[model samples]
Target: MAHSHDSTALDLPLPARRHQTLALVLVRRLAGHGLHDARATMLALDAGGTEFRRLLVLARALVVDLARTSRRRILLAPCCAAGMTRDEGLLMAMIGGGGLDVHGVLTDDAGCAIAMTTAHALGDELERLATRNDWRR
Candidate 1:
């Protein structure tokens, strides 16, 4: 959705509404972590040239949430999380939504560790799919 400088909330397109909601979720979470500049961040994000551009900005901003070491809450960065691919982010959201604890992994040992989504049916499905996919690069 393209927002004109004069457009009001009621005039926003459907896709823009979704983008705004996702961005707000991240900004609100950031505020809880004592970020006073969240409103400013939101405004800047809204100024992005395109919808995908805005999403990318929001995703990168939420990466800060992923960096925080917390055991009480799970934070997601849309289609982009630190060291995570789009598929990984979607998988994490699916599994994480199942009332399970999830977190981003920062390990120097594996050299492959990234986000940690809970293991369940979704995880099993992902595993099966990955096994059949031999073109990993």
Candidate 2:
């Protein structure tokens, strides 16, 4: 099932597509939190460049960190609500659903915590993976 001739986002290389998905997920999360203009962020992602790559890396790192604790929802709840915000829940779902596909059962905070810790320990290695040339298109 190769769409070598497709002329859509599907036609993009695998790594590029992965980064695109990552970017979209982050953008939506940020928008939900009212941290940035969704339209502008999307435009920036559409433009795609070194800066976008950096953003993807940072987003990935944040996800990795937050997933580091199942208590994150509880801990961060005070930041904006009585429990996990919609955006936080979405990020957790993303990691659990194969956005990062890190090993372990991400369904629970405990498991997510362990898996994220493993990812965080990789540090620069993760950044290198997220910012590789293939991510640029």
Candidate 3:
């Protein structure tokens, strides 16, 4: 008997491959923003379906914000895909529960270099994902 499985991204189905591509593109987008280990990040993402779509939308927004702002770094908390809702207050709730007094930061930057580079590098797929109204699909 021999084990059979998709050995490469190319071996996966079309949707799966698209997910992988999106994940890779996102990882690249984050690379300039102090994110490390592109390969590991891509693998850990395991992107697909609605949650994956949500992640893409959140990540693209975060990346865009990072690019535009002068924030030195972003603090990304670890959470499951199910927690990746569009609710902006979730992070604040998490912090409250943890007894942490954290608040948002504002920066002044006339021109953003990262926005010029990485945000634009993400291309139109991110915009498409962001604009998509049907997450169930």
Candidate 4:
């Protein structure tokens, strides 16, 4: 069976052609890897539309940093493309839930170093949470 619409409208919450276009772009990019594999990655992320926007923005920002390869290697970086890891998202969720002033930057070799003063017990809790959550700290 075939379906037709009188008007060119999609019943998506995104409500903008740009949104659909970007999604299609990402899908096509992922398709280069393999449709099934790409879909699995997308589904595994369980990402929302806003996250897609974030990825597009980051990809555009780092275009200079990324090589001009046909594979679009910039999209492969989970940190920029996917924004935050699961535990990072969870930590943000917790921070947003409360008024915690946990500000820090992640270093490749050196590990997380908070600038603010943290109590020993709280630091231990944060460390435990980081390990348990499997964050990239």
* Top lDDT hit: 2
| lDDT per residue (tens digit) for residues 1-97 in model 4 | 2223122232223212332223333433443344334453453233333233334333232222212221212122222142323323222322222
Arrange candidates by TM-score, highest first: which order?
Answer: 3, 2, 1, 4
- Over the full model, what C-alpha lDDT does candidate 2 score relative to the true structure? 0.41
Per-candidate Cα lDDT values, in order, are 0.34, 0.41, 0.36, 0.29
Report the poorest 10 consecutive residues by lDDT, candidate 2. 6-15
RMSD of 3: 15.4
- The segments of candidate 1 whose C-alpha lies over 4 angstroms from its true place after superposition are 1-49, 70-91, 94-100, 103-137
Candidate 2 lDDT, tens digit per residue, 4-27?
A: 322222211222244434444453
How well is each residue in 1-137 modelled by candidate 1, as lDDT tens digits? 22122222222222223323344344334534434355434544544423334333434444443344232233223322223333234324433232222233221112222323322332333333334443123
For lDDT, candidate 1 versus 4, the one ahead is 1
Find the 10 residues in a row with the least total lDDT in model 3. Answer: 98-107
Q: Report the Cα lDDT for candidate 3.
A: 0.36
Q: What does candidate 3's lDDT look like per residue over 1-137, in tens digits?
A: 21132121232122223432344345444544344445434533554334454455544554556545644433332231212211112222221221112212211232444432333333334434434533223
Give per-model CA RMSD. 17.1, 16.5, 15.4, 19.0
Best by TM-score: 3
Query: How much is the lDDT of residue 114 in candidate 1?
Result: 30
